[model samples]
Target: MSLKIAVCIKPVPDPDYYDQITIDPVRKTITRAGIPTIINPVDKNALEAALQIKEQVGGTVTVITMAPPNGEESLREMLAMGADEACLLTDRAFGGADTLATSYTLAQGLKKLGNFDLVFTGTESADGATSQVPSQLAEWLGMAHLWNVSEIKLKEDQAEDKVQELQAKMKIENGYIEYEVKLPAVLAVSRDLNTPRFTSIMGVMKAKKKPLTVFTVNDVDVDRTLIGLDGSPTKAGAVFTPSLSRKGERLTGDLDEVVEQLLQKLRAAGINLEIKSSSQGGR
Candidate 1:
């Protein structure tokens, strides 16, 4: 059987063009109007990784996301990037979701899709920045999880019985990476993983004819109460910009006197300076 892969993506406002993303202070919902949306940047890298895996290992790559119906634009983009198929989990009931609720909805969708060998997602959504959804989804699905992966390699070991065990190597942070136990796992990819390819005009035209599946929460056998506002554990009570206060002081003196004045200012501000000198002389 071929490996089955699914990449979870989000439709986010294009940060470069529309940086002013507003969150409802009371409802914790993102406003859609006037904000140009694009595929979440890191999620694009995740999709590219999935496509690369499929190209090398002979598998199908399915892209999935939960959002409003209009979020189909993101699906089309993924298809144009060479994903085999796309699935949308959309319903009015899935509104005002926090990371936990979002992951629950995705886990339900994954179950409905069936028989996935691996699941891919971005390390964090640009807007939320919570970095919680991928881990939560893995927990909900009872799968092993890896985070901050910059690269992935799959190796197949053939046994005498003609069975194969696939091992995955992932590049991690702190100049250290890990070799995971060969098993089905979920990975949250970092932006440094890969550069996503742009869709050609021909690819976009071809994507219009590709298969795009739409599923509601009910179609995925998800408990309605566990996937939306009712399912969320956290809420945003309020959002406000901090008022900026500007003040400055200027010191006119030689370098030593200036250094002394700076130290005095630091002391006045209750700042403690702990300096460690190097054992070896500065080069």
Candidate 2:
């Protein structure tokens, strides 16, 4: 049976420019106005996993994301990595969304896209690292979900054009646990699951001809009260950089006296220091 797989991806600020990222003082939100972006690293792993499955079985891999219009670049890159199609959900209304609102918007986008046998996502985004979207999306879709997946094995169904089950390994602290997951499921994959392939000249050329569609809040059927910042329950409390200044002291005295003063200062600061008896060694 042929499968229809969807991989959810995100565009995050480039790590090289992390030092330049800042928070908006008034809104208490990440200020990403001028920062360059890249497809979140672990999200590439999720796309790779989806592509592998499509190769093992006859299937179509579609990449989806909720980001700014510039997110089209990330989607094009995914198409070069072998996704059959790409979808971008973008709008000013989507601004300042937390994981819950983001997931809800993505779920609505998926519904409009069509039914899928599976959906894959990275364990977390590089910037947020909340590890919440996959489970939250599953809840919105009312589907089974799993996270930290490092391995997968697909099981064929007797019925034509359908998938019923598969085995997946969830990476844990000490080891990994294997589970038989039923289809039409959401999986948040870890980076260790697979190594992503580089985009080749041919793949890049092919990607140029692939369909990359953009949708906005008006296109998808979504609740106005549950699709953006207004729907986000969590908000940033306080955002500020801590002071990194240091204090120093210099002792002015003869060598022995200076050493004693240093020792006393160290002791005053709760440091444990013991001087051995010098008479035994005649120091």
Candidate 3:
């Protein structure tokens, strides 16, 4: 049986150029006007998992991203990583989306792609680091979902007519939990799952021939009110650059005097405190 797999990828500002990234105070969104982007780190892990599965199960891997036209380079990189096809959902309306709105848009894009036996995503995006999209997207699709996956195993029955199942180890705070799930599931893969394969010259050459479709809100069916900043419930109250300058004051005296001086400084800094007097100065 041939499987259809979709990997959700994100284009993040390259770490090398992080100094160029800024926040748009008016919109409360990331300003990437000039900053270059690359495939998000953990997202490559998810794509690698999808590619490995496609190699083993005789399937096609489709990589999808919701970003601006500038993200085309990131998609091309994924194609070079062996994805058969790529899709980019880009629209001015998608700006300033919170996790909920973002996931809703991505879910609509996935719906446009038809059916998929499995979906892969990074455990969290580098910029947002919310770790919410995976479960939200699974909810939107009404599919079983798992996150922080450490390992994946495929099992097929011995009978001529067989069913394939997947068992995976999921990382937890204390250790790991094992789960066996049926097909058509979603996974938020951990970076520890696998090391992504490097793109070779041959892969790059082949990637040029692959299809990369770009879509807007007009192409995919989506609720305009539920896909951007306007629909998002959580809003940024204040966005500003923090001052990095520091001031230091030296305290000199015995331990008790130093402790008393520090407490005075804290109180002066607006920290409310109530003290009970110690008789005879005994602490």
Tens digits of per-residue lDDT, candidate 3, 148-173, equal 99899877565733335789989999
CA lDDT, every prediction? 0.83, 0.91, 0.87
**Candidate 1, residue 245: lDDT:** 66
In candidate 2, stretches whose alpha carbon ends up further than 4 angstroms from where it belongs are: 22-34, 158-162, 243-283
User: Model 2 over residues 1-283: C-alpha lDDT tens digits?
Assistant: 5888999999998877887777788877777787878999999999999998888887899999999899999999999989999999999998889999999999999999999889999999888899999999999998898999999988877666456898999999999999999989999999999999998989999999999989999999999889788989987677786677778777898999999998999899988766656676794
The global Cα lDDT (0 to 1) of model 2 is: 0.91
Candidate that would win on lDDT: 2
Assess the local accuracy of residue 184 in candidate 1 as a C-alpha lDDT between 0 and 100.
70
TM-score of 1: 0.81
What would the per-residue lDDT of candidate 1 be over residues 99-118, giving only the tens digit for each residue? Answer: 88999999999888896888
**What are the runs in model 1 whose C-alpha is more than 4 Å off?**
17-33, 160-173, 244-283
Instruction: Tally clashing residue pairs in candidate 1.
Output: 0
Rank by TM-score, descending?
A: 2, 1, 3
User: Distance from true position, residue 157, model 3, in Å?
Assistant: 3.8
